[model samples]
Target: MILSSPDPAADPHVAAALLRLQRTSYAREAVLVGDERISPLLEDEIGLTAWRGRWLMAWDGVQLVGAIAWWETDDAVEIHRVMVSTSAMRRGIASTLLSRVLASASGRPVAAATGRANQPAVALYAKHGFRAESDEQIPPGIWITRFRHAA
Candidate 1:
């Protein structure tokens, strides 16, 4: 049962879920990226309103299980964030979002990037057709890998 959220960014339930997910996700990354670098983005009404991307959320009843945010480029849709609730992991939420991105791309490529040491993210992207495009050092010991999946 795939249903679109009426207003993922404004929905109270969705916002709350995303806030918690952000904290947890950043906490995991802080181990490798440092707390200063991996802190969660400030999520406020204005920030949500200013987001310049398409947003999608997966819900199991009223609970948001996953979310994806992306924007269009000249020849690609760039995925900015894809997160699945800790409780809902390994149940295809991420894959479903990736599939939706692929479908909406209309034959263009989809691009995403994550920290080089985030193995789970790297594997998840690989599992969904994304192949490594580049691995670059961002200085001060930070490394990022970009991946692209042709739609």
Candidate 2:
């Protein structure tokens, strides 16, 4: 399936879908993050405006199954979010989104981070050629693992 850019202006549905994706996906990470931050992180505005970076959404004939977004820094593209509908997990949605993003970032380094306990995300990054660069305690209680995709 082909990935498409989100049209926040034309589609109101994306706002809700992105909100739900954020809520559910981050719930798993809330153990590493407090409810205070996780709650706001699920807010729709953040996901709706995610297109300010590189956003890619996968559609299965009008139904949005997955989405991702990333920001390009001076030296690397930092993936900010990657989400697939619960029913769409393990079906290559994230992989397809990442592949599309990586293609756009061709010849440059790509990077991503996830909660240290989020093994699936770590595995996904590894599957796409990203190697773990650091695991650090960025906050009082949270451990974040940073990964970089070498060119």
Candidate 3:
């Protein structure tokens, strides 16, 4: 597997593929969380391109398998999204992408949020030294857990 930052504007095809993957990946999370209104599932290619962040993508040869997106603040990096294609789950793709994200943090803190009921995601973050700090309700009923990696 290869990891790289891809410019969506430079390749429309890749942008579309990533959008499709995001939708599919987030759809499963929606089910896990008992909500179909997650924001990632509603994003279009145009909106995705407009997001202000860096995307780290994992590829197996020419196939896109996983990706993580984040934006840096003065003291912390906020992970906006982490996804692996449905067919690519259980393959360490998400972990690899997240490892790259944490390594790029340069000692700054890193934080992310996932559905509170999404055990796989919660476990993944915990395994990487992130501690759950709180839980929040976004769409009124949907619960999300916030996690922060130790600095």
Best by lDDT: 3
Candidate 2's residue-wise lDDT over 1-151, tens digit each? 6568866545667777677776666665675454335432645665465557766888888777788878897677888888887777898888989988888887789888887777888889989999999998756567779998878
Instruction: Kindly report which residue pairs in candidate 3 clash with one another.
Output: none
**Which one wins on TM-score?**
3
Tens-place lDDT digits, model 3, residues 1-151: 9988987767898898899889988988999999998889888889999886999999888888899999997788999999999999999999999998899898999989999999889999999999999999987899999999977
**Worst 10 contiguous positions by lDDT, candidate 1:** 34-43
**Greater-lDDT candidate between 1 and 3:** 3
82-136: candidate 1 lDDT, tens digit per residue? 8777777888888898788889899998889887887878998999889999988
TM-score of each: 0.81, 0.83, 0.96
| lDDT head-to-head 2 vs 3, winner | 3
Per-residue error (Å), model 1, residue 81? 0.2
Worst 10 residues of 3 by lDDT: 5-14
Give the root-mean-square deviation of each candidate in angstroms.
2.6, 2.8, 0.9
Q: CA lDDT, every prediction?
A: 0.74, 0.76, 0.91
Ranking by lDDT: 3, 2, 1
